[model samples]
Target: MPKKYLFYISQNYSFAILRPLQAEIQRRGGDVKWYLEPNVNASYLATDEEQLTTVEAVQVFNPFAVFVPGNVVPSFIPGIKVTVFHGFDAGKLDWKGKNTHFRVRGCFDLHCSYGKDMTKQFDALAETYKTFKVVDTGWPALDPLFTTDTALNPYISNKDNRPTVLFCSTFSPRFSCAPHIFDAIKKLSESGKWRWLVQFHPKMGADIVNKYKQLESENLTFIETDNVIPLLKSADVMLCDTSSVLLMFLLQRKPVVTFKGNQQGEHLINVSSPEQIESALIDALKQPDELMQHIDDYIKYIHAYTDGNSSARVLDAVDNFTFDSLKTKPLNLLRQLKLRKKLGYWKLS
Candidate 1:
């Protein structure tokens, strides 16, 4: 018999990345299911019986090792579960194990870190975990963006994002933060110089939307929450600070503007002044060949996997790696030993 598995994500947003893995799992004769845990907010880490499975319940799934997003290893299903970081760097998924307020303890396994260099933010997470793997499975979200159609992407649902501008967070102070880059956008909106779409983090529901409402710009519509890919497509140009969402936009290779706060601050795009910001935006608006040259590298990073069929490649890697351990005990001691070492821990002593 094949292994039966229950796949879980903290929110609906992760579906794009997880779905391909899901299809791959099922293709291999493993049973797969999605666990939607409501009330699982960014502000809190307590897993609810309904919102998130209790530690005991996760154990019952008997997953042949689980694939989890980020490093906040939840105590639930502690025996199993690996981290599949859904972003470009390790900082994007910080589960210190000390911050119980943010993680359920053992909620992570191995993670990708978007193929980013592991020496910086990634080193600590690998040191802390007893078992973890870093594969170039690519950002789960990017898998769908490259493999699927624009119609499948939400921003272009209508086949057009007439004036969409996504408020992708910098994730600096916390998991995600609104960068000052958007202040420039608010200015144009207030003046009715341009119509835009400000999509905040799905986890940051209500708070940022309320702030947008306070801004009260009629030309700009504040989208509280929607899958960002579609909004990314709908917009002619994306204004953002240093973020991976810019990678997504490059998949479309659509015009993009880097948000440079001021001369004093740091940004992924080296925004030293309002002048540079205007220069970048103006050039992007004009469709300059100079800016077009960078799009090639952006696409390379966006599609880290060699093929657009990354879902298949990731699944193949997992399938070839998957074993019949489920037929024996819930886990193989050998595998468990390896897993323990992978997480940089002794087997629960």
Candidate 2:
């Protein structure tokens, strides 16, 4: 019989991250069933072939392996719980938040690291728990960024002569650069020399979302979607804060201006405050070629593989866990029950 896998999508943004892996698994003669969060919109099921399953489906299907993008998974669920991770940023400070660059909660049976730095970290954490396999499979979500056709990106436009600027921000009220750089962005948008595209984290506050939505003008466009690979492909320069999206932009070997970011490395124009926005933008747009070396070095550090085959590697890890079942670890019952209740998975029972 063909193998069966379960993909747990907790949010809309997860589609961008998990779809590549799901498609690859199906190509390899495996079946994929999506178990979605209750809040996920029906519109996300864009295909007749794509059916939304539930926690009860997971229980009955007994998939060979379960892939999760978010950190937590129900401990009681059968099959190996595989963590694919969300982003590559290590964060600006020790914020103790959910997407804290890198973290390990003993909920997963296997931990797939995107690069060497993360592999070592997960290895150390696994030693402490003695309950998971740490494998260095590059993040599958980024596969599109490497192999995408630019023409498919809806946000691209050739209507103007101005350089395209993508302004992306995290949703965190404390760490986000949105609130701090609004005035500077407004001035730049009014100049008409640069085209601005604004995209934010899904969790960004309603007031802030509304505030930027109102900023849409001739030179400025507000994009509301989870898929950013297209925007990354289309922009000349990126303006961001401490969000992991900066890493995504950097992967293009393009110039990026960051406001108060936590981690520092090559090719990033780090500004202390919003006042430096104009100068930074000028420098980045004028000499983006000069920053390629730095961007290349950072990309090598975070992701060891750039061959557009990370989806294959991730699925190989899944196959390893499923076929042998020897590498799999049993779930921590107490932790499983606690998370099930905390994340509303218990409601399904």
Candidate 3:
């Protein structure tokens, strides 16, 4: 019998991240089901691979493991709650006193960690909680970064002689570069010195997205798709601030200029203010080939598996999980309630 697994999808963009693992597990005769959240936009799901909405319905499927791309799985749901994580915990701190990047709220039985730093943190958590298992499986979401397929490009446009610049930002209003760098981008877009590509986190406000869309010109493209690998592939350099997408761009072994950014890495040109973006972009574009040595070190520190087999490693770990030997840990109800309230998901209670 195929080992049934439940993939808890809360956002449409998450589908791209977990699709590789889902396919690999199915190839091994495992059945993967998507448990869509009420707010989820299921337009990303191409086939009817079975989707459930309630915890009771999830129990009916009797999943051997529940893979959550998002945090806080329903407590009543039966299965080994596995936290696959949505993004790289690139040393970003949360408003709360606790480490928001890797805090364990007793919601997961297993944590599939990304790199050495993140893995070390989760491994410590595993030691503290005997029930929790930490696996150093490089992020499967980024597997496509190493692939050669070009059809998956989010933007379809004619190739030009001009160099490409990809501008990306995180969703957090406090840390986003969207509000600060529009003027600089607008000037660049109008100048036509290079082709511009803008892609933002899906959670970015529609108003912000629309504002940027209005500035779109012949040389500029405001991408609205969740897939960013192709954009990363085409770009000669990336510009951002504090977003994990910076790490994604680095995986391409290209130069990146970050504004007031935190995580230190080689070839990462960190600027103190928005006024420096223009110069940074110019420098990065000129020496696109300058940062390979540092980029390689950063990649190794962030992710160990760049061999395009991250999905396979994740599946192997899942297959080896001993369901009977492991006992589920009780949910930290207080913490869960607080987080839900903060995210406006408390009504779900």
Candidate 4:
């Protein structure tokens, strides 16, 4: 009998994160189903995909494992809970000034971590908690970036043969460069010296999104899409502020220019003022050897798995996990209650 798996998701972005894993599972003859939270749009599911609509439906499926891209998963679900994570840690801190990326929520049996730094952190956390295990499986969302052919990339249509720059930003008002750099970008876009592609986080303010949309011209395009791999592939350089998407871009071994980025490194060309945007882009497009080397060293520490087989590694980790040996997870009563109420499931079993 084939093993059964469940994908538990609360946000639309999880679709992109989990689809690669789903493909690997099906390739191995394992059965997979998705359980989307009510807040998530069901229309995002592909026509061939299957969804388990209710708590009862999920119970009936009784999957061998439940994969979650978000922080929490309902413990009542019949499976060994695994966390694949949603994004690369951009070193953002919580309101309390603690790194939230490594926070242990007591909800998962295994954490499929990416890169060497993250694995080391989680390995220490596992030693401290003794309730869960850690596995360095890289990130499945980036598999297509390495596996797909550049000729088939949909975002590379530059008829003018101008150097392309992709601009992206986080939605947080505190960290977003969108509001502050609008005038600089508008001026640059109108100059028609470079082709511009602007994409923002889905939660970005509509007013800010509209302003960029109005700037669209023969040289500028506003992109609205869930998958950013193509945008990363198409752009000669990326400009952003504090968004984890920049990490994804850097993995392409390209240069990135940031505006007041949360983390400063040799891998990035970080600027504090709008007046410096054009200069930074010019430098990034040149791809200086020192900057490119720094990016390569950073990639080794973060994610060295450029083989595009992270999904396969994730499945292998699941297959080899010793679930029975782990210590009992804490009874997080408040969080469990919130999930139960949110899902409207009252059954104790």
Candidate 5:
């Protein structure tokens, strides 16, 4: 019998993160199916992709392993739960001043870490939890970034050969640079000195989204898409705030200009004022030696795999996992109840 795998997704972005792994699983003669929560749009599932809509359907499928990009998964489900995280640690803090990225929700059996820094942190967490194991398999989401041809990106339209600047921001009002930098971007786009592409987080405010959409012209284009990889490939430089998407752009060995980033990193050209945006973009496009060196160093620390084989590594880790010897995960009764209620699954099994 072929190995059966389940992909439990909660958001549209999960598709990009898990598709590479799906390809790898199918390549190995495995059957893969997706289970999208109510909050996630079912329309995002491609015609060729398979989906299990209800918890009952998922139980019937009897997958050998379940992969989740989010923090939590239904422990009652019949599978070895594995977590392939959604994004990089952009140093965003929670209400209690805790790093949100490393939080242990007691749901996963294995954490497929991105690189050395993440592996070290997860290793410590595993030692403390004693329920889950850490494996540094890099990130499958970035596999296409290294392997795909950027020339085919549909968004790239620099007919005049002008520098392309991609602007992206977080949705949170507290951390977003969108509101602050809009005027400056408007002026720059009007100047026609550089080509501009604006793509915002899906959860960004409608008012703000409309405001940027109005800036579309010969020099500027506002894009709305589930996948940002193509946009990342097309841009010469990226303009961002505290969003983790900047890390994805930096992995391409490119420079980024961030607006008052929450994380202090030498790898980014962080500007405190809107007035500084243009100069920073110019400097970033130049790609100075020191900035490029810092980017390289940070990439090595976060994700050193540029060979586009992270999906294979993730499968290998899953295959080698000692499921029989694993300890019991935390009960997490309240969380379990919440998940059950959300999925409308009443059975104890």
Candidate 6:
């Protein structure tokens, strides 16, 4: 008999995208599981949130197989555990260090990204563990954004009747210069050329939050919600920093402008100057067809899945895992424990 598995999904942008797929999986008589945070109320289905420890989580679910996207809590479980990383956020502080994702994965997903730099990171990860399969599934999160009934996304109907530019940036001191990414957008705002949808990350500091709150621009509207893809579509241009939103905008093949900072690390990718920002924004505002062509050539290495059928392909790869297929070695266990200790997630009791 095919194994009845526990599909463990966690909190993040991807869960909203994959929630609808549960019915698709359930029709085949497979059980799916998820963890819901305190804030979200999933009235229709049940999810387990007790994600404090790995062994505890495994014991709680207690299914034939375990499934989870790349989350901090899923690192401790034993047996056939599949991990799917949407991007490189866990180790963004020191991205150059060895990719920790190889330690425990029937699969690790890095397919959400579409930048040239992101492809290089995955290539390095591929060199680390030949055991973990890295698959490019166009972000499963984008799937829902594209498919959800228009009623699910009411922003379009309620949108202000001005052409809008979404300015999205990640929250990090490193990306401090990113707030200025909208300087050009403000120029457009002044001329009543377009409206601006300014979004703040969940991690933004109070100081940064207050700055936006005090802003006197009527042309700008602030957005704080999980589903931002509709806003992405409604915008004429997207001004972004190093956040994954840039990748999503790229999927739209829209023009994205980064900052011209000094140090080019993970969060802050240094561009040339304001001229480049204006140039990129102008290109995005003008030639979307040309930008789509750039996305075709740019996505070759970064995100492998172009079509919206990523979830179907991923399940196919998971189906290939025969019972008792992947063997466990003693050294592998020790390496995992040692790595966890370094990450401070283990007590070794």
On lDDT, the candidate that comes out on top is 4
Instruction: Please report, in order, the local distance difference test score of every candidate based on alpha carbons.
Output: 0.51, 0.80, 0.79, 0.93, 0.93, 0.53
Mark the regions of model 5 whose C-alpha exceeds 4 Å error after superposition.
Answer: none
| True-vs-predicted CA distance for residue 143, candidate 2, Å | 0.9
What is the C-alpha lDDT profile of model 5 across 1-349, one tens digit per residue?
A: 8999999998888998999999999999999999998989988889999999888888999998999989899988889899999899999999999999999999999999997988999999898878999999999999999998867779877466899999999999999999998999999999999999999988999999999999999999999888899999998999999999999999999899999999788999999999999999999999999999999999999999999999999999999998565678889999999999999898988
- Candidate 6 clashes: the total is 1
- State in Å the error of residue 177, model 1: 7.6
| Candidate 4: Cα lDDT at 237 | 95
Each candidate structure's TM-score, on Cα atoms with residue i matched to residue i, is: 0.67, 0.91, 0.90, 0.97, 0.98, 0.69
Q: What value does the lDDT take at residue 102 in candidate 4?
A: 94
lDDT digits (tens) for residues 1-349 of candidate 3:
8889898877777788788888788788898888777667776676756677655567788898888887778655668788888888656787774657777777887788888988988888777777778899888888888865767564545568788898998888888889888888898889998888999998898988999999888889898775677788888899988887788888877889998777676669988776788898888877655566778877888886778788888877877877454556776778666645443443442
On a 0 to 1 TM-score scale, where does candidate 1 land against the true structure?
0.67
Candidate 2, position 9, lDDT: 73
Q: For residues 221-328, write the lDDT of model 4, one tens digit per residue.
A: 999876788889999999999999999999999999999999988999999999999999999999999999999999998999999999999999999998676899
Question: Which runs in model 3 stand beyond 4 Å of their true positions?
Answer: 96-98, 151-158, 288-290, 323-328, 335-349
* Tens digits of lDDT, candidate 6, 1-349: 4445554544455454554345445656666655443333344243542232344554555655455554433345443555545443322333555534333332332223223555456556555644343444455556654565565554454657765677777788765444564465556656766676777665677776666655437777777665566777777666666565665665555656566432233322236665566555665567556556665665553455555555665555566644342233224465566545644456543
lDDT at position 330, candidate 4: 96
Which has the better TM-score: candidate 2, or candidate 4? 4
| Between candidates 2 and 5, the lDDT winner | 5
Q: Write the per-residue lDDT of candidate 1 for residues 66-156, one digit (tens) a residue.
A: 6665434333343345555444432233355342212323334444444334323344544454344334555555555555566555444
lDDT of 2 by residue, 6-78 (tens): 8787777887888888778878998887777676665776574455455666788888888988878776667
**C-alpha positional error of residue 161 in candidate 1 after TM-score superposition, expressed in Å:** 8.6
lDDT of 6: 0.53
